[model samples]
Target: MSTATSSSDLIGLVLGTLRTERASTARFTLSAPWSLRSDGVEGLLIRVSLGEPYWIEADGAEPVLIQPGDIVLLPQGAPHIVRSARELAPLPFSGLLAQHMSGAHGDHPITFRHGGEGGHGAALTELFSLHLWMPQHRGQSLLSWLPPLIVLRAAEVATTRTLALATQALVDETLTQVPGWQLVTARMADLLLVHVLRAHLQSGAAQAQGWLAGIGDKAIGKALAQMHANPELPWSVASLSRVSHQSRSVFSERFVQRMGTTPMRYLADVRMGIASQQFEQGQADVARVAQDVGYASEKAFSRAFERWAGQTPSQYLKLRTNGAQIRRHKG
Candidate 1:
């Protein structure tokens, strides 16, 4: 395969493991003197404003003014309050949902009306929200690489026509509940997220050395592609440097500068991450996962896995199975 394709495939492989589930979309119609606060949420909460500006006060941060055509991503699901004015008394999001939403938007979004006593007030804010849940195993690491809050302004979105279109489509989709609208909106949401990430990477903000920065660097990007393309290969720094056509010192320095980790450490993380997923999914036994990830000795693999995962392979697998059972029972 071509080098570019391999790098893209590696990125896709990493992101594909993050499956979005239980996505619930909601639109809010709000008037002045209105506010809504959600307690700490466990999953992601994305909000886009399509109308008048509002104030969003997230925990541990100053209140942000979100203007029309602005999108906000709260990846950690931090508790936040959205208000027409900063001093408004906040209403609980749950209570607002109970009061206004009838839960009738099957496969679509539910509309919530806030701060209108008996539906008599003039509404001024139009906000759309999407609550997304990522897979447990890989999702944690994925989130660690991202900031707690990401806001894309109208001007930024305007830079990428595709992103603008996708964002606009989401706003349109929220307003009109047509047939198969859920699927279309979901696809658009995914597209918006991908484009946003790409735009962020292209910008210099994420250049502080991480996977995001590494992916944008040509030499490190090629080396990463090689490592991910064949995790089972017995890869050394020299070999990876050769892939990037750099000397050992040059490659190692550049890799660390871009990825914030050594080539060997990056390879180990990739292998272990893949192995954990395989084990969690019951796709492979302990020995198989170890071997597939390039570990020759099961004992050595178990030791390394323990150091990385905080438990031995067997223990981790058993705990995962029990957790799944508990979740199933709760469901």
Candidate 2:
């Protein structure tokens, strides 16, 4: 996180960090099928089958047939479409009445279609999008080891029955649009995500590598946890080497190969990422955050912040809080 020149790299790092934090200030909602086309998706798409089976088509990858209890991951974020059991008809974003937005804006909208005989049946379709602000990882890493797409299916377990029923209640709550029901929707989205993540972990796939792989490794997991727990420790490669019981050079190489980042860069990122979280939560004072991140002077912190965040600390905070507010309003 010491330096990131690309937005995609920053997004990959931010997505990695947010995938685990329980505070989960992020949100999820049931978008009208084309609503995803209007809303910014740039991330992941999750859909629950309503009745009929559907499939996906993408380049440099095989078209996946999705069934009940199966989840698919489109790793490369290619153009994807979900069609009925009978045909491979495409559902492009243009069909949703949105213009040039396809290429003029940021990430194209990722669409999640709830298709099945159920037809939004008793359960409302849910789409969760998580975006976090953090500096990007710098180096070759495991982020590329994962498949281009991933899916988790839950139809087989008896526990899923309860999930379906609860989702039905969510459907009712959203349709009625009761006071504070958005909170209910947000909560349900969080819960549903936990359920989906659980299935992914249970599958023991390589893609679960980000969180599970990092946290599960005896050496690297311990190191990542330590970095996260005490980001302001002014950590150095030798310090981490002592903790991981490896030589300094060995530790640096292993961390880079395993985590896709150098130790100092990761430490800088964790500290600044923590600061970013505080800013998002409305902790407005940049000077105080600079202290918390262990910068003795505001000037150094500001330079680092501008380099990592592409804005001054104050500007970054304002953008986060105000930008988040704007998104909430648009929703």
lDDT of each: 0.70, 0.50
Per-residue lDDT of candidate 2, residues 1-331 (tens digit): 3321222223334343434211111112322332222222343333444433455554435656666435444432335554443243444554442442233222233232332334434334343232211222231122233454666655554466466546544544444445555455445554555555445545565343354444444565556656665566667778778777778888777777766557777677667667766776678887888888878888998898777767787787676677667655755
Encode model 1's per-residue lDDT on 1-331: one tens digit a residue.
3356444455665554444544657777787768889885666776776656899888857888988767787866778888988888887887656656544322446776666563445548877777665444433355455666667776665655445445555656765766655556556556556655665665555647677778877788888887776788888999889888899999999988877678897787777777777876776477888889889988889998877777788888888788768655753
Task: Point out where model 1 deviates above 4 Å.
Answer: 5-10, 35-40, 57-64, 78-81, 86-112, 115-123, 135-140, 158-192, 203-207, 322-331
Model 2 ranges with Cα > 4 A deviation: 1-40, 57-60, 71-79, 85-89, 97-148, 155-172, 191-195, 208-211, 324-331
Work out the TM-score per prediction.
Answer: 0.72, 0.66
lDDT for 33 in candidate 2 is 33
In terms of TM-score, the best-performing candidate is: 1
